[model samples]
Target chain A: MKKVQDSSIAGERSVTGEFEILNQYGIHARPAALFVKTASKFSCEILVEKEDTIVSGKSIMGLLTLEGSKGSTLKITARGTDAEEALEALRTLMENKFYED
Target chain B: MNLKKALTKDTISLDIKSSSKEEVIEEMIDILVSAGKIKDRKSALNVVIEREKKMSTGMQNGIAIPHGKTDTVETLVAALGVKSEGIDFDSIDGKPSTIFIMTISPANRTGPHIQFLAEISRLLNDPATRQKVLTAQSKEEVVDTLQL
Candidate 1:
């Protein structure tokens, strides 16, 4: 639940949050697909970063390339009108471990 | 992290004949089994089938990755099959999936499975690479396109 709100532009709002991957298998294909599915539900743009690698939150392949193993932390950024809502939903998904062990 | 070890020329099929998601997965698993990557075909197929029943592996951009874990495979084993005509895979993007990559790994380990998926996913994420893979003439071409 660690998050920071940044409003650098006049009307653009962006939220950056860090969430640890709690699932036993980390961000494998299933969890990555779930994350993308949740991220795609919003109009805001989503990006996930682990270490120096940043990938589109809505891309399963991109998310897999992140190699977000168990115990790894991912920095998620949501930008645009529904940025906050997108971040909240994504945070919830991570908190639930994508509904997996 | 060695994708080539899991995928070989024998495991890559350029023209898959299956038209449905279930059939295509079976075809891919057969390829893995024929390549000696899987010992028990029934168990491997069952695991993937059950996993698919829970959630489809049909990804975006005409790609479907059906995978599962089983002790029948000592390590991570994978196969690539391409259907140029495309087939309904119930993808998130609502498009037909022409490229399929199925993987089977040991149930006890997660690192190799994730690593293999990460490497293959990253390779296929490129539009150019996908184009090359879908249009590859032979299994060798597919391997070259994937750089495996």
Candidate 2:
């Protein structure tokens, strides 16, 4: 998993990582809510791409379609003014294991 | 807008249990009905469930915001629930969640829905806030933490 430091690129800044959706049922209701909630934090235009599917990080419906299973690998890309901050924040969320015990 | 109008003390649940996402949505609908947030619990639940059939709402982190926009509601109302024991929510984090924030609103109140969602997202992203929420023992504490 490579964390892109420079988010100031003209086009979209991309960060790819393997996030294990630690929840047992795998990206169900409550977790989806949390993901949407977290994604709404940044000013950047965020997208989570899994397989061939790409979704707006801010949309609950869009996130749900990813079908993020346990131990799934996700490629999160951010664009816009605060893409760097958004990428860092998202990386924190994923690296912290989404705060799961 | 009116945060007071959006939430009532009665709409919150401290600890809740449900084996599956469907059951959790049912629980949220029941809470909405009891709080007078919605008219028909069954139909309201169906709306959320149908939406979930399209996609799972599990964002990373031990939190889930299951929401539905339907004409059945008069305004935007939210119900917050916490499961200390953790439930199998199939989160992107691959872990069970201890927190559940459920939002139900009229189809017209998109602005508040987005605003509220953003607020919750920003707060939960903070490690300190997430820690406080995880250790919170009561609904009021949970609300206070999120409201910050």
Candidate 3:
């Protein structure tokens, strides 16, 4: 479990959270797909940052380029009305190791 | 990360005959087998099928990336196939998939597999590249387009 930082400016909501990859295989195809699937459910714009590389959270290919291995840290930022919910969902997914070993 | 080096004419198919999801995947695996990249076709196919069952690799924009990790392969093996007619791959966007990229990697390693996927993803992310791949006339044309 990790803490999510929520902030809003000019009536727009933006939430950012950092999570560690605990799964043995890290963010492989399956985890990346699950992340995209969950992010696609919301209308907010989601961006995933690994190290310094950032890509759309809704894109499987974009996320794959991040090379998020085990123990790596990923920072996800969601901006829009549903930003908070989107981050929460993603946080849960990562905390659960994308439901993988 | 150089796909051009990993792929040959044998691993690239400009015209895919299969119209179903399972058939297309099998056809791609057969291509890899024909290229001598995969040793145990049954195990490779089974892993991809199982992974597909968990969640469709049929991504958005008429593209599908079906991949799996198995001990049957010593190194990462990949194949690219294009179906002009498009097949119903149960894609996330609900569109028929025309571009198929299938990969089978070693079960114990993850680096090379991820790198290969990243490279392919980068190539297919472009609309122009996708169009070229879909409309490619020959395997060499496909290879030239996928070069990165």
| Among all candidates shown, the one with the greatest lDDT | 1
- Model 1 Cα displacement at B41 (Å)? 1.0
In candidate 3, the residue pairs with backbone N, CA or C atoms under 3 Å apart (3 or more residues apart, or in different chains) clash, namely: none
Please give the distance, in angstroms, between residue A78's alpha carbon in candidate 2 and its true position after superposition: 7.1
All models, DockQ values?
Answer: 0.89, 0.09, 0.67
Q: After superposing candidate 2 on the true structure, give the runs of residues whose Cα lies further than 4 Å from its correct spot.
A: A1-101, B1-4
Worst 10 residues of 1 chain A by lDDT: A1-10
Instruction: Give Cα distance to truth, residue A19, candidate 2, Å.
Output: 25
Question: Which run of 10 residues does model 2 chain A get worst, by summed lDDT?
Answer: A23-32
Model 2: DockQ vs. true structure: 0.09
* Candidate 3 CAPRI category: medium
**Model 2: how far residue B135 lies from native, Å:** 1.9
Off by over 4 Å in 3: A1-3
Task: Give the TM-score (vs. native) of candidate 1.
Answer: 0.97
* Local distance difference test scores for all models: 0.89, 0.68, 0.87
Docking band of candidate 1: high
lDDT of 2: 0.68
Ranking by DockQ: 1, 3, 2
